[model samples]
Target: MLHKLELIDIKTHKITKIEFKKGLNVLHGDNGTGKSSVLEMIGFVLFDFLPENQADYVRETHSDKPEYGKVRVWITDIKGEPYIIERTVGKPGVIVKDALTKSRIPEIRGVNQLKAWIGRNILPMHEIELGKLFDSSIGIPQGTFINPFLRREGDRKAYFDPIMQLGVYEKVFKNLNELNKKFEPDVQGVSETIHEIIGEIKIKEELLQEQESLNAEIISLAKKLTKSESKSKGLKEKYKEIKKIKEQIDEAQKKLDELNIKSEKENENLIDMDSQLRDANTAKQICDETKEAYNKHIKLSSNLEILEQEFEKLNAYKEDLRINNENYIKESTHLKQLEEVLKKAETNKKKLPKLERIYQEHSELVNKIKEIEATIVEINAKEEQQVKLEEKASNISKNIKSLKETLVELPELVKKYNIMKDIELRIKEHEIDVANLTNQLEFFKNNQEKINQHKCPFVDQTCKNLGEGTFNEDIFNNKIKTKEISLQDIEKQIEKEKEEIHEKEIFREKMDILEKDKTTIENYKAQYRDYQDEIKALKEEVRIKPQVIKDKKE
Candidate 1:
């Protein structure tokens, strides 16, 4: 029974695996989706079959040529004995492996051998009978897949027997006999992988959020630019306002600069505004000379002038300090008050040294406090830097995780690339052999009679395969057959190599991307280390905070 199908680099399929269940297995898709191709792969893996050129089985790719296309199928006989059937294009042999142990069975090394062995072991038929039986039935006519099953008995068997060998193998073989292979892909350390995957998802979400925020900022900035342009005139006016000075102050300053009080000529300009503003003596002289009203007509000038003369006489008693002192002093009270004042002065003098000491201590305390405050400010600044470093490290951790995953894949790709290179070398060797043999074969046919017996028809200076048998008519025919087969195999290998190499090249291109990120990961690591160093320093500062406060209190 057909159990599972695996295809690699086969026509339109790159890498795909399909598991068959208890019921119907449907290949449903549009045209050129490789629906029929899947059926072909299953049949090929089972019977070691190729309906067309083997080169066509390998996938077409854009990067470099591939060396092989592969197909694998798991099946079992009526006894529930499990086996794996494996086939590869660009390589020889049909490998039938034990499904349990994955070791090759010694028999069935070739296509005919595989069919013969399958007939003998699993069914009661010869290779030719098996071929005849399957040839008409296994093609899987498109659109009529289920129609044959809808028909009765013999008609249904024609379409279905080739797939499962159900006619003689009974229900167990029809059910694919407990090989029951299911494709369940899992990673080692799956829990850790899940955590990492979750972390990556979170990081990606954060980045998306940040991108949205930046887009918002861009929109906001554009709006601000428009608003700023509209208010340009107001801003310009405010900027101009900065340079303005009060004209009144400026005028007064200018007047002060021109003021020259040393000469009467300068005074003439000063009196030009207020002529009635006279010198005091000059006004007094005028008042004494004419006993008239001060500003306008008034007749009491004589009495007021006598009173002003008496007020002026008080300045004559300025030298009578003895009498002033005697009037100020009381004999009993003066000496006692002076003694009390002296004692208080002595007391204040005695307290001055203590006050100075207290002042000094306070100054030192204030300075120590200021120093602690400065240390605190510095610690805060570094702590902010530490926070920024952590955020940056977080971003790099995400990057490093991604790069490491890629790195894990690089070694496998490189291994494949090396294998492809070896295949290319092999292809070249085969091509050279084919070219030389082709030249010899062409020469031998053209100049057959000119060469003597056993002198070598193609060689004797023309063909250089020295120890090889002479090119007689029989040998010639055999060579032709050998050449045709060799050419076919070489052609298939070359075409398949081209496709496989392209795929390997695609994987190699990722090595370039990986190398680029390799440097980036290194830089990130260096930066992360620096962040750790700075954070550690900040932590040390934080640790000192309590001690600093304790010292400050003391």
Candidate 2:
């Protein structure tokens, strides 16, 4: 029970102190006269209860000046000892003490601490328990009493679950139901797995039967494989002999190709030497012809020197004339340029007055245009400002339209949010269901034999009537091995074909090279013969040169 409540400068109301008796105490006052406020303060000091309009209780209202205040309550313990608990508004600490003994109780530094201390040491019950008791009994707000009854069953359960301590029991019941739900899938999965295992067992038995037949077939195939291996051995021996012969042929061919190449080069060198010999004979004939021309040139040399002196004097006179002509042309061009300049100056002088008049007019027009442009600029500035203002107005209108649209859709959006929350909750529930079912399924899959033996409570029937599938395991393995052998054989054949093709291509390339070398050698031999014939002709022609030139040459 609250013994007393003291408010100092709290909301600045007129009533500052209130005393309560041992029995029921009632606070009756007009509205806005601190009747409800006093009750709220009592609840706050005792249990840290805050009102919806808590700012009103803390705000200064009486004067313009700001002030700090406190809400202090005297609470009586179960032994009837009075304790003062005070909480300063807008402050960080709480003070609790023995009122009669005037000894300070241990201070609590926070609202939670103070509430905890009061609930433990001063109050007859825990704070939450007392609050529930008070709310259900004497402290019922208007309309709250009937609200629970009006709510849905789930909502009502939520409200009362904590008060009745039924949450744990409900959670346990839900978990059990979930476990049971999980067991159902487990039972079904176990049935299926048991059937599968039975089928596998039957298949293994069938495979054992098939293995006997496959063994006979394997013996036949092994005999055939031995014959093929023996044949392959004979082929390998023959192939090795063929390979040795081919290698010998390649070596002989290589030596023949080298000899052909050397012969072609020698032929080329012979042709080149023969060509050089022809060139030398031609040079000798040329030298003989040049000797005759040299004699003529010596006879005319003195006359040519005198003519060259005269030609030099004439060339000097011609160069002087060319210089005079260039000077004359330059002067004439300068005179023409001066005349054109003078003519242009005269024309400009004649147009000066008119130009000055035009300049004055242009200046006046420019000044007028500047004034007009300034006016236009001012107008454009105003227009730009108007455009900006219009844009702002348009933006404001758009904002208003958007706000109206939002207002129109707010209820629907809120409904969607609530629906989404409900869906999320349902999804979570379903996920848990899925997890339980999956776990049960996995358990069943792992423990199929147990389920088939009726060891699981959820499984009522065994998988005795289920059909077991059969598989020929040994036959399947033998087929796989056969396919692998076939694949290897095919790969070996492909590699052999590739090697043969490569050898054939090399042989063809070598034949082509040998043919080209032969053609080159033939061409070089023919060229050598032609050069030798030309050298003989040249030598004969030189030997038949005029006796006079020949004596000079000797």
Candidate 3:
């Protein structure tokens, strides 16, 4: 039952309110007195559509186009609760409010949702049933009752098809009901139990992982145990060999001790030989002096015999000569024994050639010692040269390594340069796209009315659907928003590419520097090789130096 009806800016009724009684309601009017228009408004408010042309909902005005129009119906549902259903022109929303609280029902958002909600909750029928009842039963058009059999077959089928599909829905609902019943008859703790089972499964998986790890550990330990056994067995053999080696070492130590004692005795004998050589040199010098003096004494003795003959001729000293004649005889005997000693000294002097030979050999050994010292000095010089060459080689190696590292990066840097170029080109293209889209969006916004007069009014460019002269407001607005969004998107892409190009540009600079450094690699390599050759020659010289000194010593 409709409790009230309200109309604003509708056909022939700018503002009208009508109240209906609880049992019955009637509209008393003549023809063309706006009765049918009120019925259309009721149908439009209740069913979200006018039973007649849709445009009839807009107010019929003698002025320009109307801006707003609405129809509201206050009705009592089957439970005797009053509610309001409202619909407005140019808006797709249908409002249903609790008449008691006057609060809008947010659940009934659009016309379709409200229809579905009314069918499901308010009436035990579909939305199409309400439309059929309103069209054919409640507000049957003026003379439609005369058409008993002239209804089109398609119209009858369209009406009957939804009814026929109820059987399928019945079967579907039957199956769904069974499925619902087959669910747990008692689901009091099912979710908790499921959670507990899942936790147990997770714990079981964890324990399995732990068991696997422990098994792997056991296998690894077993392998280590086998290795340890092998090592222990080898260690026992090594211990035996070490014991034998200890015995051999003890024997070698005894030999070394004996050799050390022998060396000490030989050193003592060398000291004795050195002393004997010195003594022999001193005796040769004394022998040479004694032989020369004995010759002088012989000469003097001949002279003295002549002088004594002269003394026999002089009788004045004859008495003094008789007093010391015994002493003079003793002196002559001493001189004869000294001449015999001189003869033995001359025999000793005959070995002076052998002493000279020994001295010449000693001089040769000193020369050999000097040569050995020179060889050592040469070895020191060679080692110093070797060290300098090694330093040079090390420096060359460092340079080579630096060059290698730089060369390695050159390819990647070049690749980055190429990538940066590609990104720069892409960024330019994207920026161009952004500019084009911005122009299109601006042209559409600025020339909206002119475009609508000509074509779809949605885009700046000419479209295929020309000359249709139809306008869809939603499509027009959405197309504008989409173009602007695309412009923004392309601009954002250009910004991102600019950032990428910046990073690649930095890499390109690095590539340039490294590429220039690539020429030095061969130079460093050549220097390294030359240094290595020089080091090899110096090492050879150092190696033979000790042997040269040894040959000199020998």
lDDT of 2 by residue, 1-554 (tens): 67778887666453498888878777777767777667667666775565454555665654563445688788778777888887876555688888889777643556655654565567645313444545554456657778777865444654564456555568889999999898999989999999999999999999998998899999999999999999999999999999999999999999999999999999999999999999999998997879988788887997899999999999999999999999999999999999999999999999999999999998987776666566555555655555555555455455545445435544454455434434433343343343334334433343454443534323444444332323222333454455455555544554554443444334434545544555555555555555555545544444433542433333
* Cand. 1 Cα-lDDT: 0.70
Per-candidate RMSD vs. true structure?
27.8, 41.1, 34.5
Clashing pairs in 2: none
Q: Write down the TM-score of every candidate.
A: 0.35, 0.29, 0.29
Tens-place lDDT per residue, model 3, 1-554, is 77788988877778999988877677888877789888877767765446556556667776785766888888877778889998886556578889989999764667656665566556655323556556665666777864634755434444444435565688899999888778756564787788899999999999999999999999999999999999999999999999999999999999999999999999999999999999999998987879888889999999999999898878658777886897899999999999999999899899989999999999998988887888889889889888988888888888878778768877777667766766765664575465456546655565565455554443446544555535453454677899988887887887887777777647856876776666677777888888888888888778887688668757
Off by over 4 Å in 1: 1-344, 448-485, 515-523
lDDT of each: 0.70, 0.64, 0.75
lDDT, model 2: 0.64
lDDT of 3: 0.75
Compare the candidates by TM-score and give the number of the best one.
Answer: 1
